[model samples]
Target: MSNRNIQLAVLDMAGTTVADGGLVLRAFDIAATAAGIETEGPERDRARRYVLDTMGQSKIAVFRALLGDEDRAQQGNLAFEAAYDALIDEVGVTPIPGAAQAIDALRTAGVKVTLTTGFSRGTQDRLLNALGWNDIADLTLAPSQAGRGRPYPDMVLTALLRLRIDAVDQVAVLGDTTSDIGSGLAAGARIVAGTLTGAHDKDQLRAAGATHVLPSVGEFAELILASRI
Candidate 1:
């Protein structure tokens, strides 16, 4: 049976847990430029829309959609990954204010905290290594291991199974993208929340099935705590 209290929190990486300074988008732009996708033409416009629209999805998948071929998509992803790596190396990544506190609070409350992301494990490892957060969460998963990425239940469900969390309804799925909410809802999690910090707006998140939309992940623990009280 499902518990009224949230027992698991499966969080997204980029905009939800860590503040990437919108570098992901900038990296995509670099990939676009590198892939010859364009920057000032009609094709460029379409590519831009696609990148923005596909936020929270696998980077390779997004490139696949934009480039329209597997090989080209891989090329684009490689360029994007390189750009993101360079950006992070130049400017370090920091947790959203109180993000680490929130994670700590959740774990203190006996709720398993796991991170799931659209980045391949290699990129994910690079970022986590930079942040020195490799062992911070209970578990970290990438789509490459989960079989599918965001807006899909695979990663969330995989996390649950790995954590031995039995009741899906006791899970809280929170992120900064609609795809996160979609995955949560599809996985039958009890609490699905969104943050306004990322690629999505309030209306877009609500339309995508978020139970609550907050300003940032910093308030996440407070939100859950308030619910328990």
Candidate 2:
């Protein structure tokens, strides 16, 4: 098919597009510590594991899983938000290598780009604005807008709707986690997995049903270009 036939490209935020480098985890640590949960050595490891295992899940869902109860989770979430907001300035967040160029190329080729993230709208906007990406994305869909979260395909479907794309074959979902791959597969979109991002390795991504496992966003862009050719 021609490049013009591709209508949309749905991208995941955290690991797929931006390299936050454990900024979210650090926020969780601050929140957990504020909640009187000590995070030292093994405990810290466990907390990190929890974050990694649920990388693509909604922020609320991740909080609930870590805090163990809805009430506690709410409290922790508040702390996390405060800590994240405060540290966001100091936190090193850069677009993943080749991400900007790839996105530009795609847009120049008439591909609509939609970003689906598990972050709250407030947080997502903050990050985008801070990174000078406020106008770079065609549409930004958040988990808060979805009734259900990752592993459920709600956000991905929402992005598709925003893009006004009916056929899943004309869209590609690119992400770096099992949840991401699962959501894309569930939505019947072509899945391009990124390994240099999220916690998932190539085998894990493939196991989750990724159509293509690429080393980085740049490689994925090359694949997309080749497909058009």
Winning candidate number (TM-score): 1
The top-ranked prediction according to lDDT is: 1
TM-score of 1: 0.95
Candidate 1 wrong stretches, greater than 4 Å: none
* Alpha-carbon deviation at 143 in model 2, angstroms: 0.3
Write the residue-wise lDDT of candidate 1 on 1-229 in tens digits.
7557877899998888888697887898888888888678999888888777778888888888777888889999999999998988888888877788888888888889999888888889988998888878999999988898988899989988999997898788889888999999999998899998778899999999999999887677777776663
Looking at model 2, report the run of 10 residues with the lowest lDDT sum: 1-10
- Candidate 2: which pairs clash? none
Q: lDDT for model 2, please.
A: 0.78
Query: Looking at candidate 1, what is the lDDT of residue 153?
Result: 96
What lDDT does candidate 2 reach at residue 151? 75
TM-score of every model?
0.95, 0.90
RMSD of each predicted structure: 1.4, 2.4
